[model samples]
Structures are given as structure tokens and as C-alpha cells.
Target: MAPETPAEPEPMPAPAVILVQPQLAENVGTTARAMHNCGLGDLRLVEPREDWLGDKAVAAASGADAVLRAARAYPTTAAAVADLHRVLATTARRRDMVKPLTTPRQAAQTLGGVIAAGHRAGVLFGPERAGLGNDDVALADAIIEVPLNPAYRSLNLAQAVLLVGYEWFQAHGGPFDMAPPASDSPPATQADLDNLHHHLFRELEDCGFLRSEEKRPGMKRNIRNIFQRAGLSVQEVRTLHGIVKELRHGRR
Candidate 1:
């Protein structure tokens, strides 16, 4: 009998990262560097500022020339994400549209699942100064928001790409030094967390806990990030509300 053939290894899953109207060749190169660092190879450019393969970009890439060389360019955002089944737009600021919003971790998991199910996915990064326009964002099925200090939340193009890429790596069962303990309570949905944020913010605002209207946004965002990191459950959220109420009443 013939020897059994060796089984083929499972193909690696990666999402396409599309840079929409990128402003700097250096940023594009750095983005390529970041993508390669996280084992993501698909790079697409939508109307980049300079020749992506030029000297400056190559210099910035720091030996990720293969990624730069294999990159594809498109004329518009629509064309960029045309063939993708799942599309996510990365932005620091919240848009007014009603769309499924996800954290980087959540988005990565969703993207990984989609790819595993035999679908193509892509992430869109807007220009440096101005992020995705409503039109560009409208094309995305979901918005990926990185919890950050609201006062200074702007992330450089490559930095934003790196973060999402890192999450994607982790989502795909990438080896890591540590893993978070599973939550006892059901995972809190984004809407549930948002409601808690609103409830807490209203109370804080009423009691002047977050003073300095100018700093209020940043302060609230920082507080929210703290809770988000904790991965609070429904029960925990209610308990915190009770504690806040009791403390406020006692002070009064």
C-alpha cells in the first residue's frame, strides 16, 4: 500500500487593509511595516499621495519591501472594498450614523470568523488629517473604535493599522504570553456598556464629578476605558450604579 500523503496545513487567514487617500508615502510604508509585523500581507492603497514604491516609502518600510511591492492601488474607497464581504472602518471620532460599532478586539474576532467561514474581509483607514468621510464610512458594515483618551485621540495612520493588525493576530489564535480569564457573567454587549456609560456620565455630570466642560469628553472617555478594560457584566454594571447612588446620597 502507498504511504498516506501528508496533510496540508490550514491556510493563514488575514484581512485586507485598505488605506483610503493616504497623505504620506512614509505613513504608507510604515503601515506596510506594521502589517507585516503582525503577519498581515494584503495591502491596498486608495489614491495615495506619492508613489508608494518610491524611495521615501521604501526607506520608511524598513525592509518590508515585499509588502510594498505586492500592494494594489484603487481609485476610490468603493472600489477598494468592492470584493470584500465584511468591511470595517477605523475612526477615532464617533460618527453620527447608526451602524454596528465594535472595539478593535471585537472587530478582529468578527473578521477572523468571517475569513474562517470562507469570506474576504477588509479594513478601511482614512486620510491622516481628516478621517473617513460619511460616504467612505457608509460603505462599511461596521465601525471599529479604539478606546483612547478622548482629548487627544488622534492616531497616526500606521499606529491605527498596527493596533487592528495586532488584534487580528490575536483573534486568529496567534501565540501570546497571556490570556484574559473568562468572565463569569455573560459578556456585556456594546449597547449594554453604552447604556452604563450614559447612566454613569449623567450622574457624574449632575454631581459635578467631571468638572471643566472642556475636559469632560476626555475625562469621561478615560473613565469609560477603565470600565471597558474590566469587562463588566450586567450585574456588575447595576451594582456599580447602586454604589454610585449610595455614595452620592451619603455625601448629600
Candidate 2:
């Protein structure tokens, strides 16, 4: 009998690189090139100011036209991450939230584990100038802060994405040999969490729980951070929805 060739290993599950409100097409192109270099192809843009797949972007992407051509644009950060099971936001400065913090390498390891378990993950990069806002950061399950020089920590959009992407590429297959952690239920998607947020917020508003316009934003963010850190499962989210609905019905 002829010897049979071994089946090839499956390609690593690459996380989506999401750019929020990116300002320049060239930056988007360069970002695409960087992603391509790391074997990543999912490029998502939220409210980009420039045409990401335009001539300038294409020229800047060089031969990475595949990433640019397949890029998806979203209207909001929430919409961009709605389908993701795990999300990490890249930030330059410390925030007031209590989410888990990790370096690019650490985040890459975590993302690799998540993907190995058959869940989708993504990293969010904010605008070129301001980076991620508190609102954008709150949506993430964790924060990725590159431990750069404290004296002058300044990186452009593509540079930041490239740093993380490189780490992710390096760490991709490291987790595949190990067994994924067991779970009773699948993790909640960002869309499920968004629905829970909106549902809970509506009930809170109806019950006059968020009457203070000055504090409402902060309060909402705190609530989001709490749930985000909980790592709620799909069943847990549904139970919470039921709890919220029951509470609202009791009042009526």
C-alpha cells in the first residue's frame, strides 16, 4: 500500500483588527499590510473618515489588497464588536475602569486560548489622535496596554495594531496543543451583552434609576464594566434578561 500524507494543520484563528474612527486611508492601508504580515485578514472599521479601500489605501497596502478588499466597515463600535466573543481594546493611557489589563503578548496568549476554544475574538484600536475613548474601552472585555517608555508613549494607529498582531502571530499555535478549558455553556456574544445593556438601562430609566444627566454616563459605564468583567455565559445573559423583565413587570 502507498504511504498516505498526513493531514495539514488547520490555520490559526486570527482575531479581527477593529479600527474605530480611523482618520486616514493611508493608515488603514498600512494597517492592512501589517495585518497581512501577521496572517490576519479580518479588518473592521468603525466610522472611518476616509475611504479605506480607495486608491490611496490600496497603494499604501502594497500587495496586501486582500485584507483591504475584505475589510468591513461598521457604524459604531458596538456594531463592530457585536458578534465577537472576546474583545480587547488597545489604549495608551490608564483608565478609571477595573477591567483586566494585559500586554500585547499576554493578550495574544489569551486570544489564542479563546480561539482555540472555538470562539471569535477581536482587538479594538481607536482613532489615530485620541486613541480609545472611555465608551469604547468599556465595551472591551480587557485592556491591552503596551508597556512602552513612560516618558514618551506615542504610537500611531498602524504601529499599535502591528505590535499586537505580531505578538498574536507569534503566539498563534502555542495554545493549540493544550486542551481548551471546559465550559457548560458558550460565552455570551457582544450582541447578547449589548441587548442586556440596553434592556437593563431602559428598565433603569423607566424606574428613575438614571435621572442624573451629569452622572448617567459614568454610571452606565460602571455597569458595563461590571458585567464585562463577569465573563457571563449565554445562559447567564438569558437569565439576567429574564430577571430584568420580571422586575419590570412587577412594577407595572
Taking all chains together, each candidate's TM-score versus the true structure is 0.67, 0.66
lDDT of 2 by residue, 1-252 (tens): 989999898787799999999999999999999999888999999999999879999999999989999999999999999999999999999999999999999999899889989999999999999999999999999999999999988999889988999998778734544654677888999999999999999999999999999999999999999998998999999999999999889666
- The regions of model 2 sitting more than 4 angstroms off are 1-7, 173-252
Instruction: Give lDDT tens digits, candidate 1, residues 1-252.
Output: 999999988656799999999999999999999999888899999999899999999999999978999999999999989999999999888899999999999998899889988999999999999999999999999999998887888899999999999888877746676756666777678888888888888888898888898999999999999999997787888888788778777665
Which candidate tops TM-score? 1
lDDT of 1 at 172: 79
lDDT of 1 at 110: 92
lDDT of 2: 0.93
